[model samples]
Target: MNSFLLALRASPLRWLLVPLVALDLTLILTRDGYWHGLWGDTGAAGQVPTLFLGVFAAAAAAWTSSLRRPSEVAETLGAMPRPGPQAELPRIAVVLCVFLVPYLVGQAVCFAVTASSWPPGFNQYLGYLLLGVASLLTATGLGWIIGRLLSSRWGAAAGALGWLLIVMAFDNDLSVVNGPARMQPDLLEISLRAAAALLLLVACLWLPYGPRITRVSPLPGLTVVLALVATAAAVGNPVIDERHGSRTKACVKGPTEICLWPEEEKYKPMAQDVLARAENLPPVLAKPDAVHSLGLVYTEDRRWGGDFDMDSGSVWAMADGLTMAISAETFAACREKDFKGFEAQLKADDQSVLALERWLEKRLAGGGEPEYREEGMTESMAKAVETGKEMADRPEAEQKAWATATVRNVLGKYCDR
Candidate 1:
């Protein structure tokens, strides 16, 4: 314990520890996903902070490991029977302990803050987090090995920058925690990486000591072979399962239901309100019965199945969902004719429904067309928005009458044909 404290105070790493922790915490909390309340997204986003953490750890380990003394070998032999460094052991321990505290704290904030918001589901990925910690530990081991071999500060600088470039530019599973993760982590793959890191660290422990071999060593060759296997698996094999179909949904149950991804519970009330307004359509026209978010599993039922952008809480996004819901009702109730390859009539029927949806969207905005989100807005949709603006001056009853007549016209033109 005293050796640990002495090494910490004496090492140059002492200057970096405070800054590293401050910067790490800052990065974690300030990321776009911190307030998202997404269990999977938050878990996946953790890699951002871990990137710097690993780089710093590797650089620090190399910086200290390269420092040598003439009596160090003799002192190591006199101090303990252990094969690893005595003073250097304390240095490694102190470096790891300092960086680990901030990493763990940042992770805890992610879970605790997300849990506070009542996310759709809690997918505890302790294994992925473990893989993150192990990544840093492995980098530290490499730094020491690199420093020991090269014995220069340039090696430490290169190791740090090289680690960053590998993580950002390279798409290796061993280094990347899956960019913008789909939320489903392959536990088996995570475990394999962790096991490989542990093996690498074990080898690192043996590198600075042991009797200089008079003959060629087979152990180094064996380690190289195992690393090749890990590499192929990391690159050639898929390490993550699909994010969809992995979790259940949080539904706003009603005759006109709205179901969103479990992580998007915060938007449920707004989704409910959006669907509820659609329920008030004229009795002559079709109304949606159920609406499911885009993130949910796929279904063939047009009336019951669709996805949404409720994750962003944009009102226009809700309008888009409303458009999908009501359009499904329009198709199912009024029906469509094959036209026997008559593309012109088919296209006209589609335009008629789109016009109805656009006008209905204006109604959903409480009788005035506010600036609707233009993201995914189409040429037909823009025309529909203009149609809504043209009709905005008329009474609500006139608008309802037009919507009802349009549906009836579709039913007559297509259903009767």
Candidate 2:
């Protein structure tokens, strides 16, 4: 323990101070960025501790590098002729502690702070700590092993790149969090990956020196554990296929545990309903005669943002009233033979109208699906409204007349009114 601490203290802790300070500054400045628009937000401070991890990795890499050529301690140990396999245990234990304990503590602190405002019995923050520990250990271990393989210089650079990629993968919104779909990995997978990386590191450290081994093979043990754990995870994965698209590589990778965005058409019915109801819905959902402006309800609150998912409590709270109203409008428009006006309405309200248009154009250029059905707005009227939105602008009077005519046609044909 003394030796390990000495090693850590002896190193250039001063160099890491810059990044640690910078990370803290960034966290303080970006407090609002981490919010999910919920009761208790994580705020950017939640990620502040991770900065220590980066500094630790960099420091550990440099420290581990010095061990390559025998040190004064190694020389003294060599002189002890009959050194047992257990003799090196202290240093190894110290290494493990240095790599793991402090990071875990930091993560725990972050988790506790974030989880405080959450509902009682929710230990997600603890889970995050465990996750963070697993992550850092894995990364540091990999860096250690790589430093052992290619000179420490190249290893540090590689480790940094790997860390960046991992962060990018996590921030990607398209990936699913908990599912049996493709294109994303789960927390379990991430831990497994980390474990695998640690094993690889230990193996790299001990395996190269011929048969007179000072260490028990880490690979065999890790492999067995990983195989069993992975099999169990795959067997017990609960996300249904319908909720996720065909399983993709992202689903299996560590940290990305879910598939990318669900197949677009799966939610078509729900989307149609929202559009249909929204069109004819009175501004005030509680009262029938109130003319609620669509912009005020959807835009002001950012109800259409990709944030509030179907299963979320927020979505549930707003759905019955909001979705119902949106659905009515879309349905009413579709029923009215005013296809043009219907399209225009869709264009006006669709959260992803521009994106869809761009996507459509790209798809057409690439010979992909040109006629895409939106899962967010499902009713026939919503679909028509979406179509109108795709067209160039028409005169306001013409648009209004067309909308009225379409409504009459819908009433006469579909409602038999």
Candidate 3:
């Protein structure tokens, strides 16, 4: 214990860890709020501390391992009655604690701040935290082994750069780490990755270090085999796990209930206002009070520019979605019949749907002509618009009945056929 404390006090690398950890924490705090309250953002934020810690930890571990080369510590320790592994345990423990303490604290703080507002999936967050710890262990262990074996003056720089490149190239792109947009990695993937990292750490720790010409250690070889197996388990499964968090919805009550995913709850009022505009249609055309629900689907399409806005295009899209939902519900009554040969019918249905969408937009804009025009106006759509205008000229009751029937026919027989 005394020797460990003295070693720690003597090592300049220990002092360097403080500034690196502070920098990592600063980065995490600054970016944590940028994408707050969004699905997958929490796990992504959790990765920030790991990103900075891994590089510094690897470099520091290498430097620490190199310190023994200039001294008689290893020789003196070997001459003692105690075993080499047991004697060296304190130094290894100290180094690991130095790297891991900041990581654990930073992650806990990040999770706390995010959970207060965003409330992410606990299981997923825990899995990512475990993965981060395993990653740090792997990097540090590898660096320590390299330093011990090579004793190169450039070992620290090489360790830092090499680990950083490997992490950036693989961690962000691999599904086992961040997963794809709108998805989170499966528990199996996280588990396998964590296992592989730990196995590699074990291999680094157990493998004998020498100047040249050595036989392989059985423990390290077995660890390498197990690590490969764990990696295979991660890479073999090709299916991207769909994110259930995105489907988890919270609703706000109004004339029409506005349902949105929790990440999109900020736009509930905007969605309510849009639905209230939708309520202005004729009784039959308006959504029924019994089944009055508007589910907002948020798209990350570049054209949409992300999030709800008062822009004409965005308003039109929201109004269009309301009309589409109504049409879908109206068509549900006609599902018993089987329709075939739907190629032309599908085109006609699209035209009709677009016409209805345009009509709804005009109504929502207070019966004025739409200020913005949609691109790619098809000929069939123009004909449908003419037909819609004719129907609008009819008596109010007749117009309502015609609109309901058209939606049913188009969605049920026309689209399906």
- Give me the candidate number with maximum lDDT: 1
Candidate whose TM-score is highest: 1
**How do the predictions measure up, each by TM-score?**
0.70, 0.47, 0.58
Candidate closer to the true structure by TM-score (higher is better), 1 or 2: 1
Q: Mind sharing the TM-score for model 2? A: 0.47
Off by over 4 Å in 2: 13-29, 33-59, 66-74, 80-109, 112-121, 162-307, 310-417
Q: How displaced is residue 64 in candidate 2, in Å?
A: 2.3
How many angstroms is residue 289 displaced in model 3 relative to the true structure, after the best TM-score fit? 12
Candidate 1 vs 3: which has more TM-score: 1
Of the two candidates 2 and 3, the one with more favorable TM-score, higher being better, is 3
Candidate 3, residues 8-55: lDDT per residue as tens digits?
776665776677568757866776253344334455565656766778
Q: Tens digit of lDDT per residue, candidate 1, span 1-417?
A: 998888788777778767877887798766654245666556655555777788887787676666655677647555777544353467678778767777777777767776677554455345456657766766676666556555554768966876666565545454443332234567677666666655665554444432222232477546634653564344344455545643567788765677776666666676667667666678865557666666465676633235555433455666667676776666563443444323543566356666776676665555544544556767766676577556645777897788778778767766544
lDDT of each: 0.62, 0.39, 0.56
* Rank order (by TM-score, best first): 1, 3, 2
Provide C-alpha RMSD values for all models, in order: 5.6, 13.1, 9.1
Question: Candidate 1, after superposition: displacement of residue 387 in Å?
Answer: 6.5
